[model samples]
Target: MSNQLDLFHVQRAYSLAQGPLSNDQLYQSVAEAAGLASDALNQRCEIGRAKAKRSPLKRKIRWYQQTLKAMGVLRKVEGRRGVWELAEPTDKGLHQAPGRVCLLAYSTRLGVAIWGDNNAVFSHLDEPIHLCVTSPPYPLRIQRRYGNVAEHEWVDFITQSLEPIVKQLAPGGSVVLNVSNDIFEVKKPSRSLYIERMVLALHDRLGLSLMDRWPWVNLSKPPGPTHWACVNRQQLCVGWEPVFWFTNDPLKVRSDNRRVLEPHTDRHRRLLEQGGDTRVTHYGDGAHRLRGNGFDTPTDGRIPKNVMIKGHRCSDSLRARAAAKRLGLPAHPAMFPTALAEFAIRFLTREGDLVVDLFSGVNKTGMAAERHGRRWIASEIILQYIKTQAELFSQFEGFWLNPALAVDSPDRTGS
Candidate 1:
């Protein structure tokens, strides 16, 4: 049996403010209006309440209504009993109750509470994942020191390891694998094993297709060097890493072609007022039409390119060290920044869709999922890391950590 805190919160909020509308009713309403019965109006309300338990429920409901209305899922009618309803008739009744179970188990909102051996995740996931962003262990000799397999074994291991996950990925979904070449000696650089080989293996072996290659450049320099280099400085290394963006089916991947431009500076404005060409200052060569509220504008004056700059660093936590020692798990060497994960979540997923990280390291992806309001499912092979992540999320979000919340405490007081 799955937990129902997420579902109960959504249902209770809907019940208190408006009449209890069945999932079917909500679905039908959405389908009629938008041709897509899947709307997150109620789902968002549930997540908002789940996150902000200290806040008043009325405030949470207001916030939910506003968010959904802005997203064009809730419509306001002019009638005696005009109220917020689904924008269209839903083809299928709202299955939020069952859906919430899946989310609560591994959702991004709840954070990295659900983690353990790989089997724990496969059992819990009910639907195919839409997108996956992860940087698994690289093929390096040093990796073996941490109990990870040797470098030569990576190809076979990665291939066999991801087969089950690929099976669970939706045909339309995509996976972005970020990896880099490992350095062994100061002067000797191993033949750069192109990640394309793995991409090809997945496609030929598992039917996953390579869609794109995203170059992740770490602008910041790493401090100091290994045994090979006494103190390497400004090493003309291949700083850019490869992120193989693969999809089960190429057609479903969506790219938002919007850009955010910097406003004209005062100097440029003054020049424009003087009847100067001002074209270079006001409308740059690559300028495009802006849309949506100014707040949600995309960065970079152009649609985000495949190559994303790695500008953020991993979180620093002494607590993680303690937890690692207690749990007897090797420390994670590299973790993607929450900001990077957030970018991927926003660009790849809709508001309420599930975002998964197959190889969760230190729960960065989970934190990103919570920040962006996306449901997440993450799996970590190590037990210690899982426990540490669960504790961190429970303390930070104030959500019930135990999955037994459904049967152990139906009162919902823990939330």
Candidate 2:
């Protein structure tokens, strides 16, 4: 058989084996999947006059299996003779080879979920990323079940996490980071300046330029910081978080505001119909000027402001949480709204571009990218979270779970 056909048979063998399979079973599974006749599959190869002949197809399968193992795709079962299985996750990353990432799951033609540490996975990325968007764990006063660094160590932690990833970004790619604004100093009322430090660190370390600072106002957020805001009367309720946008090259940043435009409000529509203001208007002692026909022309939609007024209780997160509950799994602690991810994705990238999220909680970026016809790659350390994300993504049209990574059944862990 040709090398390409041999490779196809080998891949089929790997995919068909759900658990540890013996050599004979693997060969039979591959033969069945590829519709190969037993005679063709069992063709013998001559070695020496005194030795027994071996099947060439089986030898090729073994060779390809070793190659896949070198690429971190398969593993040999310990204490079991001639048995093999798909590689499992380890604390250091996937267990086979160094500098190779394992795919946890993937859609038919849209995206993939990488199973491992973000830093380890980022270092092995071979393709350029167009958009890198994520809401990493917040640097809180108290740590949550999902890992988060201390307030004082946040800048360093984030810098280390993003440096390698940014190095693989396309020339004009953008990185949108959502950071909490409620992180306060230890035993003090003053807030930490980690966001500002992060901006400067990325700029100095990764040569990225700050594009804009968008404030995401969660309208449905309840009052928090109870001690300072409600009891001490020292701080006001913080209902907004800062989202920083950075680019590899400021002059050529890949962005189009028109893609994320919102529908015109009633007042704005009326103003357009009325042919704008009749008289020239000036504010701040003529410093700001408004022309009479400025609003006369109609448009498809209005350009959105930097202040995004979105509710925290988005339907996507709600539905995902309910699904987790139904499956007897713990709900994700912090799931950013899919709308927010969609806004950034549409504004920053065109269809078919690659969007990446290293700290994916529920893989919202993947969902948003899939909805908009963009390719995506999401990496998360926690197995349960990635499994939950896979369940949600399976509902997408044309979704295809990677058979090689589906052997290990999911165990309920804190989300």
Candidate 3:
């Protein structure tokens, strides 16, 4: 097959140098074309096959040839056989210099690559991303500082800077913003209401529709003192972070399958254990069996509700520091758990779909995409962070490493 293809290319090149040929001329003059037995060609092309492989290479070649013919690169007459011809080079940007960043695509393996800055990413993407999951830096003066921009400034960044990238997204693509309200102890008022209003402003101003809110319930302790001594001491602060899901086109955003499942609660379990009493007779045998066993059987996999528990913390904490030392990389502050990213990716995208994260903090989303066998593009603003993340990622052969690091490794504990 290789030899045949080589001969075909050689013959075609030579024929083009000479002149275009008729069907008979092509078949007679071209070495491989002349050598290709009609019966064999028909069999290889699957012209007479009852059942053909879906998206076969031979069919792809035929389609390519047809497209070339349509574009006047090949000569094909109605009721006549097709003849190949070289396409004339156009003086358009087709001959212009290629972009700096180039992506090498694959069919099987997930595409994982990191871009350092916004400039590096905007022009290099081959396919528009279907889903983008990110949590941008809040207005809080935290461990690290990207900028000290005010609320209005951040809103402008979303509308002016990020909106362009959002426009590049596919018609049905979605953006999930996992931002939290800023708590200013000095002010003594929650900034959540202001942030929520800003989010609404962005949606309305940018023409993006709000799909839903995913509440991230934080089980961690709150900082600073409260008015009441008891309230301050035993404050079971139920911190809820808002995750706003937005879409450029609502119709295009389909349900994601990776939505979190509600585990059976203790009350539900107790009811199931007792089953229905003599007064209450279960209709279905399966229902009765489930009730008798004290287990709540799951219904269909539906879209996940707004509220979600903070199953794992982001990469910046002490836990992440330990994991990073064990894994041999610098800990990232904004890394979302792979589980969360996986859930969102599974629900929002099909197999082989592209996922993009503009604020690629720690590359968690990219790692998740790789684990789930989906392609992803990640862009981080900070160069140091990009280098750190790349080095960390390069250590692993796959998405996750084996023998997961202990929560309290000595090196991590020291940090």
Inter-residue clash pairs, candidate 2: none
Error of 2 at 37 (Å): 38
TM per prediction: 0.56, 0.74, 0.55
Candidate 3 residue pairs that clash: 256-347, 257-347, 272-294, 273-294
Best by TM-score: 2
C-alpha RMSD for every candidate: 19.9, 9.1, 19.1
Q: List lDDT for all candidates, in order.
A: 0.53, 0.77, 0.53
Candidate 3 local distance difference test against the native: 0.53
- Please give, for residues 159-268, the per-residue lDDT of candidate 1 as tens digits: 77677677888767777777764434335533445464677788899888887777777777463234333345434445566777778887877433342133556765
Scored against the true structure, residue 106 in model 3 reaches a CA lDDT of 14
| Candidate number of the best lDDT | 2
Residue-level lDDT of model 3, residues 42-107, one tens digit each, is: 344333467543323234344434534543344444454455554442221111111222221111
